[model samples]
Target chain A: MSFLIGDGMTGGYGSADILHDCTIAVEKGEIAVIVGPNGAGKSTAMKAVFGMLPLRLGHVRLEGEDITALTPQARVAKGMAFVPQTQNVFTSLTVQENLEMGAYLRRDDIRGTMEQVFDLFPILGEKRRQPAGELSGGQRQQVAVGRALMTQPSVLMLDEPTAGVSPIVMDELFDRIIEVARTGIAILMVEQNARQALNIADRGYVLVQGENRYTDTGEALLANPDVRRSFLGG
Target chain B: MVDILNALVLFSNFVLIPGLAYGAQLALGALGVTLIYAVLRFSNFAHGDLMAFGTMATILVTWWFQSMGISFGVLPTALLALPFGIAIAAVMSLFMDRAVYSFYRKKRAAPVTFVIASVGVMFILNGVVRLIIGPDDQRFADGERFIVRARDFEAWSGLSEGLALRSTQAITLVVAILIVIALFWFLNRTRMGKAMRAYSDNEDLALLSGIDPARVVMVTWIIAAALATIAGVLYGLDKSFKPFTYFQLLLPIFAAAIVGGIGNPVGAIAGGFVIAFSEVTVTYAYKRFLGHLLPENLAPDGLVQLLSTDYKFAVSFVILVVVLLFRPTGLFRGKVI
Candidate 1:
């Protein structure tokens, strides 16, 4: 069994379903990437797994324990951290303050976790006192990811973490994400740069209109001629 | 030299001292307004009445204290009664939030809806304060009135004009400074305060981080109530307590908040002083002070005051309008209203 699973999920923002029987799962220390065309419900699948989307007809389980009814906040308490694609950082707050707020639920000392985040994103440490709003887009994304890591969550979820950054920053962020996964945390992220994302992904799911069209090992998915021709623009 | 010294004394006596005291009161009042705007994301029209309500509570307690022969000696007995007033105000604020504002908040109502709801609260609070305290002026200040008596100053300085500093004015400045310091410290250093700022900055992200919205809102109300109570008491001590005056004060208070940038605390303080000095300087009759400065022949006969004190609120209105027109985000780049 996967460490975390959103099995057969079906739901949407309202009556009209955005996700249909979508299944996404990630094992411990593995990176699972979700990618597809625009309006293909790729982000919806991630939201469903994170409990941000109300699942109408599916179950999510963490280590075989059902968590289908939990809220996003409650899921955070259960060791899941989500980095939103936009407005992810507290613009008015300093970078350090943003990290502190992420660890608000923890009673123990958060200094160590903050230090770890700084290690993961060293620029954040250098600009710790600067307000997150003052940073550039890529730096702001780093602050967002660093804030989520401060929670010391078992699973880290990102929604198109590299959506608007330059290609160089995107590669750097991907490298950082790989480093985070090496720390034995399950990483599930939606990516727009599908080729680069699959290059580092352990498993990849190709979503089409909220349904999984292809699920395979990252290397195998990259090599598949049909996936290359249709989705990867071969 | 004597003419210059007398003119300086006259300016300090009438304009500087009064402006400082008035500015301190407005700063405190505007701080409360700014905090609510920042965290709750609405302009609370009821804030002025809340101050009146808190002042009324303090006045009642002061009257009781006087009857019991309790006093602060050199300071007004109202100072001792302040905490009880603050507690009452805090409780009332929490109740108002829970009973009135929370419903709109739960509905995710628009900021305009919240503003209109606050107007309803303002009417209720205004009525309640008037009913309990009566519409008449209540002078609760009882202490050694003059920190620097005019006659004593004249004797000491040997000047035609004597600078008199009222104890209430001194206390107002002192207390206002202390409260501002404490508030800034709390906001910058404390954990709960950071949570409040984070919530104010980004509500969705704050929720995702597990910072409880209810707790932040409750704390914001409590702090705002405390500030309003303190400001009301100080202003009452400096002048006199009247429900109608406090109700009327809403204009200047809102003007101060808006002029300073609606949600910025530092801007509130700056805005308060700006409005105060502008009102005082514009309305002040420079007939006597000019006599000291200018040659006897050059000194004009008519009062040199540009505006009447009766139009003091208009100064704030003008400043508010000017600020909104030119820089809506305010002097400190606070959130635009």
Candidate 2:
């Protein structure tokens, strides 16, 4: 069974549906990437899965349990975490404090979890005491991901993780994501840099105007001439 | 030399000592205001009256304690009754949140609307407190009068100037410090305190991390109630309790809140001192202090006071205006919303 699934989801901010009949699924320990043209509801789909938006039709499930009516807090307790594209980190809080906040629900000691996140992003550990706002774009993204990792979520969702960073930094972020996937955590991320995203993705989803345009293994979508011309910049 | 000593005494009595006490009060009150702004995402205009309500509760309980012959020696009976006052205030705050504030929060009301609603709550609460306590000055501080008498100071130092420290004033200062220390410790060290900060920083994010908003709100109110009760009881003991005086107290408390960066605790404390000093010093007649420093001709005409005692609140208002104009976020750059 998939770790996370959004089945025939349709919803938006209000009456208008930004995600129309969108279906995406991520199995445990796999990296699923969603990429498309602007306004394709990439972020909206992620929001729907996380219960941030109203679902007019369809439902979301985690570990085969329906969560369509669950509040955001309920979703967190179910081992789900989401990191937005911008303002993702609490800038005022130190890096360590930010991570502690991610593990807010846990009654157990999170020192091991903190160590795991620090191991993934050594730069974060090096600057643990620094305010997140002071970090470089790449380091800030690391802090964002590290914060989500603190929850030890069953599935980690990120919207546009490398939206604004240098090419080298973006590559490094993707590598860290892969490293996170190796630890048996399912990852669902939306990416603006479509080609690179699909290249590293185990599975790729192409969305257009809130509808799924194509769903295939990352290699198949990369080789498809139609996808290359329309999404991947021919 | 004698004149300098006299001036120092004048400054200490009117500004330093009183400012410290008044600042402590404002600091506690503003901290609650800041917390509500941070966690509830609204400016609680009702905070001042809430403080009054807490103090009113304290007065009643203190009166009861006194009648029952319960005393804290020279510390005043109000000190013993404080916990009961705090409990009542906490219940009131939670009820206010559940009945009024939470509906607005659920509706995602505009922040301005929330501010207005708080004003409405303020008036309603003001009426309720008055109905229960009556709009009369109540002095439940039954104790010995002076910790240090003005005559004693004069005799001990052989200085013409004197520093009179009332038993209540001394108690107020000591209690206020203890409360401040306790509050800071809670905010920094406790789990609930951290959760409150998390919700304040970002509500959506907080929810995503499984931090319950309702629990945070409850905790915020509890701390706010404790602070308000302590501040109210102390202020009442120091001077006297008049429901009208609390409404008047709002001006300075808000001025202090605005001055310290609205969401910053340390800023609130600092702002309280700033407002207190300005209020006491601006309205203070500095003629005696300046007369010693200046030539006889320079000390002529009026009391050399920039403002009158009746206009003490004006001092705080002016400072607030100035701070808002130059730094709208506050002196400490609180949440810029």
Candidate 3:
């Protein structure tokens, strides 16, 4: 069993099921990337793992404890942080304030964690007083990740964090994710840049229509001829 | 020099002082409206009635205080009674939220649905206030009425025009400044305040960050209730407390909020002053002041008022329309209405 797993998850937003026995798992200090074609239910699978969608059948376990009944907020208290694809940062709030809001549930000191986040993204430290909305797309993404990291979660999940940024910024974000994973936080993210995401991923799950079509080490999935020709655009 | 001095004093007497007081009242009212719009995501049509309800509570308490012979010594008893009014208003507002707004919220209703629901709430609150206070005007203000009497000012300044400063006007300005400072501090410096801002900025992100929606909504209602109560009491003190008059005030208050940028607090204050000054200056008769400024022979003219006092509310309507047409987001770039 992995450290965190959504085993055999099956559900949808409405009556129509978006996932069918989909499974995803990640261990501590490793990067797990979910990548596939458009409408492959990549984001849906991630949403299921985060408890944003109800599961008709299956269970989510964190450290062997069933958390399927918990709300999304409760999962945050259990040290899971999710960064949405859009509207991730509080546009009206300053970057520092955005990070402060992220640590709202914590009763302990979060200044050290905030400082570490600033260290991770130096530009955010410089523009801490600026409103998150005023920052460029890449800088805003950094602020979003920094805000999520303020909670010091054991698992950090990103939903296409690099969606609109330039290629250079995407690489920078990927590097930051790898660094975050190195800090012993399990990194689970959905990525559109499949080849680059797989290059840095320790484990890769290729989802097709809400079900896992291939689950392997990142290198093996990248080397596989079928994955290359069909999904990765050989 | 004497002509200029008299003209200036006349302008100050009729426009500046009254405008400031009225602006303060409208700003406070609009601040409450803007807060609800920002956090709750709806235009609360019941705000005017909420003010009336709070003022009614204050008036009853003031009467009680007078019966008990309790006074604040040169301050209106309403000031002392204000906290009770605020508490009542807060309770009422919370009850309304739970009983009415929360259901629509749970249903994921559209903004228009929330607005129509608010209109229903408005009618109910309006009837409740009229029933308790009656349709007649109520005078609860009891204090030293004038801070600067016109006769004393004329004698002191040795000018033809006399300037009078009412105690209520001074009180309104002082109270308004203090409240604004405290509000800004709360919004910027406090943990829960920032959480509220975060929630207003992005509801999903705030929830994912573990900020409770119920707690935020509760706090917003409390603060808004306090603001509405204070604004109502102050306005009643400045003029008179008539339930109908308070209901009529909704137009100007909404104008202020929309002109300032619907969900922006700073914009509310700016919008308030803009509307108040426009209404005051446009309706003011400039005949005497112009006579002082011009030569004696050239003073043969009618009352030079641009608009009648009956058309005062129309000024707000015009400004609201112009703002909506040119910059729907408001002067400070607030959320588009």
Candidate 4:
């Protein structure tokens, strides 16, 4: 069974439906990547799972518990964290303060979790005292991810974490994400860099028009002629 | 040495001491304005009127306390009656928010709409205070008036100029500092304070992180009410309480809030002193101050005043205009409060 799953999500911003029978899931210790064209509801699917947008037709389950009716804060308490594509970090707060805010719900010790985050992104540790706004795009993304990690969640979701970063930074981020998955956390990520993302993803999902067009192992999706030509731009 | 000492005494009597007390009052008032702006995302035009209402409540309570033979010894009984004033103000503010501001908030109305609504509240509150307290000035301060008398100072220092330190001035300075320090501690060290800051920074993110917006708003109004009451009572103790006077004082209070950076607490305190110094120094007749520094021939006729005391509010106006024209975000550059 999947650790986290959004099975057959069907909803939109208002009256119109943007997603039609969309299903996505990630198992424990696996990295699942969602890749698609712009306006194809990539971020919307992520938002649905995070409880930002309500699903009209389907339920979201975290470890077999239905969380469809839960608020975002309730979801966070149930070991779920989501990092948006933009404005994901608290800009005015220092990197440490941002991390502290991420652990707002935790009543236990967060220092160890913070140390682990620092280990994942050493540059963040170096610039811990600096405001998150002062960091470069790559570093800011690290802070955003680091903040999410402070909650010590079993599942971590990223919406285009490497959207504006350099190619080198993107590779490094994927490597860190893999390391995080190795520690038994489920990762659900939406990426614009589909080819590179598929290189590291345990499972790859190709969403077109807010519906599942392709689903397979990352290596299989990368090797498929149709996916390579149509979706990955040959 | 003697000349310099005389100049120092004259400056302290006219500008330093009074400015310090007035600055404390304005700082507290501006702190309320800044907090409401930070949390509710609007400039609270009704803050000054809230102060008047709160102070009016405290004065009535003090009168009751006085008739009942209760006192704080050398301190004014108003000091002891402060919590009642704060409680009344908090209740009124929350009621106002529910009746007027909450509807617009639910509509996701613009900041300008809130400002207009607060103006409506301001008028209503003004009318209420005037109706209850009457339009005339009322002095409720009852205590040992001075810590050091002017005659005592002259005798002790043997200086040409005398300096008197009023009990109200000492209390104002001390109480303001304590409140500011406590506020800083609350915001920096407490979980709730950090949550409020998070809400101010990004509302959606704050919600995702589990910060309750209602709790933050309630705390903001409570703190603002308490600060406003203390500031108003202190000002009334130093000067006198007149409902219209607080309405007029709003200009300088806003000027201070804007100058220090509207959403920043520390900036509000600094801005308060800036406005106070500007008003006091500009309106003060500095002939005595200049006479101590310059020779008899150099000390020319006429008061060396930049502006008349009657136009003291004008000083704040010009400063506000200049600050807004140049740096609308204020000295601290908050997120457009």
Candidate 5:
């Protein structure tokens, strides 16, 4: 078993199973990208892992311990963090306050953790006093990530972190994600920009109809004809 | 220059002083409503009745204190009894939340569902308050009657128009300002308060950050209850406590909240003053106040009242309609709110 694993997961929001025997995993210091079409259950699988949606017939384990029954807030306390695709920041709060909220469960001083987050995204420090809502889209994304990093979690999940930003901003975010992974934190994210997402991904997952169609290295998936023709838009 | 000073004194006595006191009352009521809307995502139609219930509680304690010969010296004895009233109101709010609101919340019911439920609560609370205290007006204010008497003011200023300052009105203004400041400080500075703002801003994100929704809701209700009781007690001390009058206050309080931008606290205060000034200035028989400013030959003949005091409540309705027509999001544009 990898460090974080959603093994043989099968669930849907309603009665029918959207994720049919879907399995995804990531190790320490690895970046895993889930890429698929619009209705390919990319977000659903992530939600299932995060316990936002109850799984009917599956188990999710972190470090070989079952956590499928835990609620999202409980999961957060257990060193798991998820940043949603949209409305991810508390827009009314200052950038610094947003980061402080991320450390809600921590009993110890989080100043060191906050400084580390600021180091990863220095722009967040400059805009610390400004309300998150006033910041640009890319800058807001930085606030979101900075907030998540305040927890100093071992594993982080992101859903389409670069959904609406310009391409240059997207590349900058990907570079930061790479830096986060290099610090030995496992990264799992769903990506709308499949090509760019996979370019830096160590493990790439191609999901179709909520099931894993291709599970391989990013470079291997990029080189495969079937993956490029079908999902990758060859 | 003397005429100008007299005019200013008249305005202060009739409009500014009363408006500020009434504005503080309305502001507190609107704050309660706005907090409920922000955290629970409901209009809380029962808020006015809740105020009535809380004031009834305070009045009961004040009567008991009076019988025991206990007092707060020059201050109204009701001030000493306020905590009991706040506690009662807070418990009632918690009970209502658990028994009524939590069911619909768990069902993920529509906002309208909560509104209808609160209307039911409104009727129940109104009935309970009247049953306990009766519908007749009860004047619980005791101790010093006036901070500055009209005759004393007249002697001091040597002006024809006398400025009467009620102790209740003075206390209301000071207490309201302190409450507003403390509330803003809590919301902007404290961790729990910021968590509340964050939860109100985006619930899903707040939950993701490990902020418990249940705790937030509980805290919101408690704060709202405290505000309601204080506002009701102050207004009761300023005017008088009649269960029916409190039921009537619902319209104006809601108007204040909406006029200021429903979820914005600052807007609520601003809206309170707006509604208060409009109601007072419009309905007031301005003949005397204006006669002080105008030349004797130009003195008016009529009462010069824009609207009668009997239709003062309707003023809120009219303003509500105008505000809704012009700006649906409200004066502060609390669209996200």
Candidate 6:
């Protein structure tokens, strides 16, 4: 069974729907990537799943249990975390404090979780006392991801993690994401780099103007001539 | 030598001691204002009236305690009633947040809208305080008036001119120091304080981190209320409790907040002193003080007051304008956003 599901999301800021009956699922221990052109509502779909945007005609489920009405904080408590595309880190807080905030809903001792996050992103550990704002772009992204991971989320959603990083850093971020997936966390990420993102995705979704045009295994979508021509820059 | 002694005494009475006390008061008040601005992302123009309300509560409680025959000896009876004032003010703040401010917050209203709403709140609170207190000045400061009278200091030092340090003024300085130390510690050491800073730094990121915005707003109001009460009560104790006096103090407080770099606590404190000293020194008549140092014919005919005493608040206003014109961020370098 899929660990997280967004079934038939249809909503936007106002009257017009940015997402129209959109469905996306992330299985346990897999990287599910969503790629689309600008104005395609990729981020909107993520927000709907995270409960940041109102759902006009859809429901989201985690492990087959409906949680469409839960607030974002409630979603965090329910073992689901979302990292937005920009300004995702508390810039004034130290690296450690940023991670500590991620575990705000948890009452237990988070030392173990902190150590685990540090293990996953060693640069964060090295600069734990430094403010998150002082870090390089790639390192800040790592801090953002590490902050979300502190909740020990079953499904970790990232919105365009590599949107503003160098090519080498983007490759490094993808490697860390693959490593996170190895720890049995369902990873749902939206990306602008369609081809590279699909290459590492266990499942790839191609969206156009808020509707899913194709859904397939990563390799299958890469080989699809139409996807290659339109999205993959043939 | 005589003129220099007189100037020093004048400086001590009007500038050094009073400036510190007033700066401390403004600092505390501005700290709360900055917190709300930082966390809530708006300038609460109602902050002055809120301080008035807190002081009004303190005045009522002090009167109650005094009537009950409870006293703190040489110390002002108002200090003993401070906690009660703080509690009531906190509750009032919570109510304001829950009833008025929260609606705007939920609507995600523009900061300017909040500013206007705060102005409305200011009027409501002003009316409420006036209705209860009768708009009259209440002298709640009882017991010894001065720690050291000028005559006594002159007798001791044989300087012909001596400082008159009021008991309330001394208390104001000591209490202000303690409050500042305690506030800094809370903001730096406590989890909720850090959460506040985080929220101020980045609101969306804070929400994403599972920090409840409502709880943070509640906490901000509570702290602001407490700080406002303390500052207002102390100001009243040092001077006199007149509701309108607090309303006037708002301009200077805002000047301090802006000068200290809005949303920056340390900046607020610095800005407070800056405004205080500027007000004192600019309007201060230096003729007498300079007379003793200069030759007989060189003695100036003017009072040497740069501006009249009535326009002291104007001094702060001028400094604020200059700061804004030159460095809009503030002298202490605060966030412009």
Quote each prediction's TM-score: 0.99, 0.96, 0.99, 0.96, 0.98, 0.95
Q: Candidate 4 lDDT, tens digit per residue, B14-45?
A: 89999999999999999999999988999999
Worst 10 residues of 3 chain A by lDDT: A143-152
Residue ranges of candidate 5 with Cα displaced over 4 Å:
none
Better of 1 and 6 by lDDT: 1
Looking at model 6, residue B27 earns an lDDT score of 83
Interface RMSD values for all candidates: 0.5, 1.3, 0.4, 1.1, 0.7, 1.1
* Candidate achieving higher DockQ, 3 or 4: 3
Q: What order do candidates take by DockQ, descending?
A: 3, 1, 5, 6, 2, 4
Runs in model 1 deviating more than 4 A are: none
Writing each residue's lDDT as its tens digit, candidate 6 over B247-288 gives 888888888888988988899888878887888788878887
lDDT of each: 0.93, 0.86, 0.95, 0.92, 0.92, 0.88
lDDT of 1 at A18: 94
lDDT leaderboard ranking: 3, 1, 5, 4, 6, 2
Clashing pairs in 1: none
Error of 4 at B46 (Å): 0.9
Q: Mind giving the per-residue lDDT tens digits that candidate 1 earns over B1-337?
A: 9999999999999999999999999999999999999999999999999999999999999999999999999999999999999999999999999889999999999999999999999999999998897899889999899999999999998888888999999999999999999999999999999999999999999999999999999999999999999999999999998988998888888888888888899989998888889889999999999999999999979999999989988898888889989988888777864
| Native-referenced Cα lDDT, model 5 | 0.92
Best by lDDT: 3
For every candidate structure, what is the RMSD over all alpha carbons to the true structure, in angstroms? 0.9, 1.7, 0.9, 1.6, 1.2, 2.0
* Greater-DockQ candidate between 3 and 5: 3
Error of 3 at B11 (Å): 0.6
Q: Count the backbone clashes (under 3 Å) in each candidate.
A: 0, 0, 0, 0, 0, 0
Residues A116-223, model 4: lDDT tens digits:
999999999999999889999999999989988888889999999999999999989999999999999999999999999999999999999999999999999999
What digit string (tens of lDDT, one per residue) describes model 2 on residues B162-246? 9988887777778878877887787767777777777777776777777888888888889888887787888888788888898
Error of 3 at B246 (Å): 0.4
After aligning candidate 3 to the native by TM-score, how far in Å is the CA of B313 from where it should be? 0.9
* Better-scoring candidate (DockQ), 1 or 6: 1
